[model samples]
Target: MAASCGRRRGRFAGGGGGPMMASIYSMVALVLVLVACVELGDAAAAVDVYRLIQYDLAGSPFGSRLASLNHHAGAFPFAPGADLSRTAVIIPVRELDLSFLRDYITNSKPLGGLLLLLPQKISEKIGQVRNILAEVEHLLLHANIPYPVYFAYEDDKVEALLMDIRRSDIAGQPATATTGGFKLVVSSSEPKKVTSPTISNIQGWLLGSKGEGDANQLPTIAIVANYDTFGAAPALSMGSDSNGSGVVSLLEIARLFSHLYSNPNTRGKYNLLFGLTSGGPYNFNGTNKSFSDVAKEMGVTLGIKHKKINVSNSRVAWEHEQFSRFRVTAATLSELSAPTELLESAGGLHDTGKLVDEKAIYRSVKLVAESLARHIYGHQGRNIDIFADNSNLAVNPHYISSWLNLLSRTPRVAPFLSKNDPFIAALQKELSEHTVEVHVQHEVLDGIFTFYDSTKARLNVYQVAGVTFDLLFLLVLGSYLIILFSLLVITTRGLDDLINIFRRPPSRKSKAV
Candidate 1:
C-alpha cells in the first residue's frame, strides 16, 4: 500500500509542475521578443530623425548661381513668354555702385533680372554693402521698375559662369543676344511706404560712483558697438561679420565690468558708458541718435573730459593709410584689383570728428594692443608697435561671415576666432582689469529685412510611425492569456485528486494497524 501511495504522489507532482515550467519558459521567450521589438522600433525612429534631403540645381545652365538667385528673388515672370527680356545681367560687386545699379535697372527689359555677385573680401564692409543694396532696391521701387533683382556670394561655380559669359561672343551685348532662352529671374513684393516713422535708439550707462552730483564733474569714457546689419531676404543678413564680433566683444566686456563694479574691493573712479547702437550700416543713423539721447538723459555735454572708443571692425587705422610697406601674399595681391579689394583698400579707415586728439588716440590704441599681446603670449609675446607702418591692425578680415544669416559656407582659408584664439583670450583678460570702468547701452535698430511669399516660406512637416502603448498593451494581454491558460490547465489536471482527497474523509483511521 505504501509503494502505491508514493507512485500516486509522484504522478500528481509531475502533472502539476509540467505546465508551471512551460509557462515560465514561455514568459522568458515573450520578454525577449518584446525587448527585440522595442530595440528595432527605436532604431527605425532614429533613422527617420536623421534622414537627409539633397537639392539639385541641374535644370539651369548657370547652375548654383541661378538656383541661388531664384531662391532669393521669389516669384517673377520668365522669358520666352509674353515678355521680351533679353539679357540676364550680372553685376559684379565692384560695379554695384548706386549709379550703376540704377542705370541697369532703368534700362533692363521687362523680363531681365539683375544679379549681384559679391566677393568674399566684402566681409569687412558687409554693412556698407548691404546699405548700398538696400538703396538700390529702394531706387527700383521708387522708380516703379518691375524688373527683378537677385544677389549671390562669390563661389567657384559662379566664377566659372562669369568667365564663360565674359568669354562668350555675346559679352556686353544687348538683351536680344540671349532672347527666348532660359535665364535666371528674381523678383520681390513691392515694399510698403512708411508715412509716420517713429525711430527708437537703445542707450544705457554704468556709473562707477553713486554720486548724484553734476554730470560734468565726473570723467566719462564710452565704448560703442554697432548692432545692425544689411537686411537681405534670402540671407536675412544676420550681420555676423559686420558688427557681430564687435557686439559680442562689447557685451563680454560689459559682463566682466559689471561683476567687477559690484565688488567693493575692485571698484574704480571713472564712469564708463557702453553703447550698442543700431543703424550703423545706415550712415550711423542709430548711433548718432543714441549719442544725442544719452547726452540729454545724462544732462551733460560729452566733451574734452569724455573719452569715446568706437568698438567696430570698420575703424580707420593709421597703418592702413601707409599701405606701401604692408606685405600681402601674391595670391591675395592678385585679387587686390577686385571690387571688394578696391573698397577695402580705399575705404578701410574713415575720419573721426576733430574732438579727439590724434596723439592721445594713437597712444591709447597702442596701450590696448600691447595689453592684448602681453595677455595672449605672456612675457614672451612680441611687442605691438602701432607706430610702425608695417604693423597691421588686429582686425579680422572675415567679419562678414560672422553674420549668422548670410547663407554662405565658411571659407577654407579664413581663420575664424575660437575660444583658443589669443586675441579673444587676451581681450577678455584686459577687460577684467578692475582699473577700467565699463558701461553698456543696448539698442535695436531697423534690421536687414527680407520679404517672403507663402510659397518660399512654407514649413515642411514629416510623419513618423512609432510603437504605441496599444501595441504594448496587446502584447501584455497575449502573454497574460498564455500564462493564465497554463495555470488553468495545471489546476484542471490536479482537480480530481484534490476532490478525492477532500471527499474521502480522514482515510478511515487505519486504526491500530
Candidate 2:
C-alpha cells in the first residue's frame, strides 16, 4: 500500500500544477471579466427628494417637465459649454443668481436634470431667501424645463454628495462615461394627467333664536375663507398663513358662536353662515358665501386696500371678489393693499409653519370674534372687552397652534388631495360640531388650468466608477493575474515546463526503436 501511494504521488508531481494552474487561471480570468463588466453606479446612496412642480397651464407645459432622471452630477458654476444636456447640475439655492438663471432658462439651454439644495432651516429662510427662492420659483414655474428638477433639504449625506461632485467639477472633470463622478437617478413612471381633480367646499350654518319668526329666514352673516393653497411644488405647498390663518380664525369664531347659540337665552338674532372654500389659489374656484379687527391694542394697524375690480380683467384677486361677482354685498379686510400676480403668493417654497405667528392668529381671531359678537349683540361700536382674557369666549392659542401645525404638515394642493382626504374630513367634522346643515360640495377644478401628477419622488445619488477607471482596473488585474500564473507554473513545476508551454513540442522519432 505504501509503495502504491508513493508511485501515485510521483505521477501527480511529474505533471505538477499543470492542470491545476490552467483551471485556476481560467477561474481568475472569468472573475476579472465579470468584475470589469460590473457597473458601480448605485453603490453610493439614495435620498428622499421632492420634485419640482410638474403641471400644465392650459396645455402649456410649466415647471420641471421631466419626472425621471439618470445622469452624472454637475456642480454650480459649471464649466462653460460643459454639455449640460448629459449632466445633472447640483445647484445650491443660496448660490443661485437670478440673472444667470433667468438667462439660462430664457435662452432655452438644455440640461439632463437639476437638483436644488434647500437649507435645513427652510422655515427660517423665508425672510432671508424668500425673494431669491420666490424669483427662482417664478422663473422655473413659468418656463418649460425639459429636465427633472428636484429639491432636497441639505443634510450630511447630501452635503457629502455635493462636495464630491463639486470637487470633481472644480477639477474641470465633467462626470461622464470615461471619467468617474457622481450620478443622480430617479426612477418613476411617466407623469399621468390628474383627471377631474376635485376640491370640496365645507360650509356650516349656525341658526340663532327665533324672534316669533323662522331664524332660518334671518339675514345671514356669512364668514367665508378659502382653505386650499397652491405652490410651485405641489407637495410642499403648506399654506400655513395665507388661508390657513383665515381658516383657523374662522373655525375659532364658529366654535365660539356654537357655544353661544347652544343656549337660546344668549343666541343672537342674526343667522351665522360659516363657509370654508377651496381653490382659492385658483382665483377662488370653490365658494359658498360669507364674509377682522383687534389691530389697535396689539400694536397692529387695521388697513384695508380696495382695488377696483376691472370688469375686463378676467381675474379675481381676493376671496370676497368671488362673492361680489354674484352681486352679493362683500368687503375684504386684509393686510395687502395691492394684489399679487397670478399663482403668486398662493403658498410657495418659503411658506412654512415655523414662520406662522400664533399670537397674530390669536389676535386676529379675537378681533374678528369681538367685532362679530358686538354686532350680533347690538354693541358693535362699543369698547367693552367681550371675549376678555381667561374668559369662556377668549381665543385659544393651543387650538390655533394645533390647527396651524396640522395645516402646515398637510399638502393642500387641490389636485393631489383625495376625494375623501383626511384633512378635508377633519374640517368637515369640525364644522359639524359647531353648526347645522354642514355641507361638503366636491367640484372639479374648472378653468383652463390642467395639472399632472408625480409631484414627489425619490432620488438616488451614486459615486460611480467610470468606464475608463474600470478598464484600467481590469487591465492591471489581468496583468497581475497573468504574471502570477506564470510565476506559479515556473515555481511549482520548473522554468522548463513554463517555457515548454510557449515552445512547440518536439516530435518523437517515430519507430526508431
TM-scores for every predicted model: 0.34, 0.85
Across 264-340, the per-residue lDDT of candidate 1 in tens digits comes to 55444546565555444434444411222223332434331122333343332221212212331111101122222
Q: For candidate 1, what is the TM-score?
A: 0.34
Per-residue C-alpha lDDT of model 2 across residues 18-87, encoded as one tens digit per residue? 7687678768878866776565433577888888887777788888878999998888886556567888
C-alpha RMSD for every candidate: 22.1, 5.4
Q: Looking at candidate 1, what is the lDDT of residue 490?
A: 50
**C-alpha lDDT of all candidate models, in order:** 0.37, 0.81
Best by lDDT: 2
Clashing pairs in 2: 222-290, 222-291
Q: Which stretches of model 1 miss by more than 4 angstroms?
A: 1-86, 92-111, 120-146, 156-180, 185-222, 231-249, 252-263, 281-513
Worst 10 residues of 2 by lDDT: 288-297
In model 2, the runs with Cα more than 4 Å from the true position are 1-41, 123-126, 288-299, 310-314, 474-513
